[model samples]
Target: MNRPPELKRTLKNRHLQLIAIGGAIGTGLFMGSGRTISLAGPSVLFTYIIIGTFLFFVMRAMGELLLHNLQYKSFVDFTTDILNPTIGYYVGWSYWFCWVVIGMADIVAITGYTQFWWPEVPLWLPGIICIIILLTLNLLSVKLFGELEFWFALIKILAILALIGCGGYLLITSFVSTNGIQARISNLWSYGGWMPHGWSGFFAAFQIAIFAFVGIELVGTASAETDDPTTTLPAAINKIPVRVIVFYVLALTIIMTVTPWSMVAPDRSPFVNMFTLIGISAAATIINFVVLTSALSSANSGMYSTGRMLYGLSRNGVGPKVFARLSASGVPQNGLLYSCALLLIGVFLLYAEGDVMKVFTIVTTVSSICFIFVWAVILIAYLRYRRLFPEAHARSVYKMPFGIPMCYVCLIFFAFVLYLFSQDKDTLTGLVATPVWFILLTLFLPLYRQQLKKRISYTDSKHNH
Candidate 1:
């Protein structure tokens, strides 16, 4: 007799840590922050803080639930155990859909970044190149994925540190920019004061701000393949707050300090703008390359997670069996190919729309909305776990603080963000587009569940042999 194949726990502590960091700092922070800054003014700082704080609680809830049962591969599994199997099926596929939407946005962003260097190049060319490269890298092995993320994250970190360090130097020396704007801490408040746009502007920032944190749960998905779940999972989860502060809050603080909120262009990246204003001749090229990789890193993560989610769903008979097959390297080859194929549609969008930011905004809004649903599912699962197994919650080594109350609070917060999305015309399109996915899922669910039962029975009989 032979044993069945399974996911390898080849991801080490370093891989896990860097993946966590990479997930925290997404393409949105680079490509979308300029718009958020424009919308919220200096108070955009508080927007990141507020969103990060709530999501920290969400991650804590997720960490506690995932650590409680090692057999539970991801939140999808726990949703099945604590919630219902039907809802679990929905969450699993929705999560896959969430990543696909994000992958499309990344595709658009990569094209936009590429045009910075080669203005004459077609937009679709860069996206196609990126997909092929990511597909090749991801098909090799999960460790290769980890290694890719580690280097990608390192690049992002060094880039930010350089920005912070350079911005800090400008502030300390009161160095004047080529534009004649002198750097100073008071630059944040001097232009328009904090909350310049008042609460409406602060609240408006939530739509894009939420997109920045979409992949924060990538750590949870990777936990099943992690080397030591008990140690690395908690370590990664706990640092999310600090990562959010330094990478998002602190970096933006410095950017606004050197370049006032009024001066930061909504369409261009403030990171590149900061460097260009400080008279770095190659600023646009350098930061363009960084952001290009940042989008690639995000798309790479999308490839990895969508593959695994598909593999997870297939194993439980919720998806097609072909997706359940793994390559010799223990990678989900079929799933990877399937997702990559769907991503090509994004290239078509780029050709059709001929506008990157418009496509980026609409797709990202859809991604953000779906992610909120996925996070809500985790919180619901946690509440159920507390009800069914009080002793388990009591005995847990890593407990979610204020678990019950915070669950409700996070749920309400997500709903509020959705409401914010509806108010804007651009985000409103995304808000409208999201329900189509759920409606289609509801329509086909019963047929899929019927097939699922048969598949499960056949597998059980084979094992009995």
Candidate 2:
């Protein structure tokens, strides 16, 4: 008899490492940093550090929970098993929707980036093409998706390294730009002495900073496909601090030191701007290509995440059973197709609105709010693991440090971030609109429970016959 289809453990250690790195560094760090620096001045560096520290704990909790049972496909699976099935239903679907929104925004972003090179092309065309390309790649196999992300992430890693290396050289020589601003470390404090806009601006920076880290928990989702979860997951989670330092802290410091925080444009990418300011017009074009790939990488990860999330939901009877079926290549082909089809809404939005920036803002804010819910669910699930599975929690080798306490701390931090969202009109719109999703999920949850019960009965009756 043929074996039932399942996700394969084909992802290598290097794939997990790159995926972790790619998740931490995204378009938010590339494009949104300009707004962050402009709003918080040099103080944004501290904001990254603070937020990264708390999120690291969140990752630790997830790592421990994932390693506790190698059978769990993703955090959503454990969330359902440990918590009430209803809560799991909410988190799994919400996490899937989070990526769906993020993927749409990324598609819109890819269109905008392509227009930089081809000014006359219609925006929706590039988005549609990108979706098709991503769909083809994802439908092949999970390993192929990992391989593509590995290279996409490698490009971003090299780009950041290049920026830091060049910026360091400029700072060392005190090189002056064509605009006549001298590169120096003092640029960090000279403008307005760190916290330039006071505590309020520093707090405001959290809204954008949190969005940058939206996909950081992707490793949790990739657990089932990883070759060696016990060693690989903890190793990847532990290195988050180093990644944050080199990718966000060190990279941003170099950019600010080279160009001064005041000169960064809120609407443009700081990576591209830094290259242009230093008289390397060619480098700016190259960086644009890199940012374009960065957007693609994010969208690619979004695709992988949505498909896997839907598969997990389907296995638990919350989603259509079709999504649970795997292809001969050991991939969730149906789930992948459904995700790509939903993502076409991005193309529609582009064709309808013709204002990529406006649409991107609304979608990104909504995505961020949804991500906050998902992260909160992970922490809550971790708490339940500690109380309900004390033996397993105690025996686990990769136990979360300061487990319950840290979960509470992270939850508190999430609350503060949500309050920060309410402080801004753009993000507040997303915050207000996010509840409709939950209300809708609540309404449909009972129907899902009924379906699940019917399926269970049918299976039992067939087994008896």
Best by the TM-score measure: 2
Candidate 1 TM-score, C-alpha based: 0.94
**Model 2 pairs in collision:** none
**lDDT of each residue in 93-124, candidate 2, tens digit only:** 98888899888888888988898899999877
Q: Which candidate has the highest lDDT of all?
A: 2
Tens-digit per-residue lDDT, 76-148, candidate 1:
8888667766777889999998889788878977887788778899877989989998899889878889999
Model 1 spans > 4 angstroms off? 354-363, 451-465
True lDDT of residue 114, candidate 1: 80
Against the true structure, what is each candidate's TM-score?
0.94, 0.95
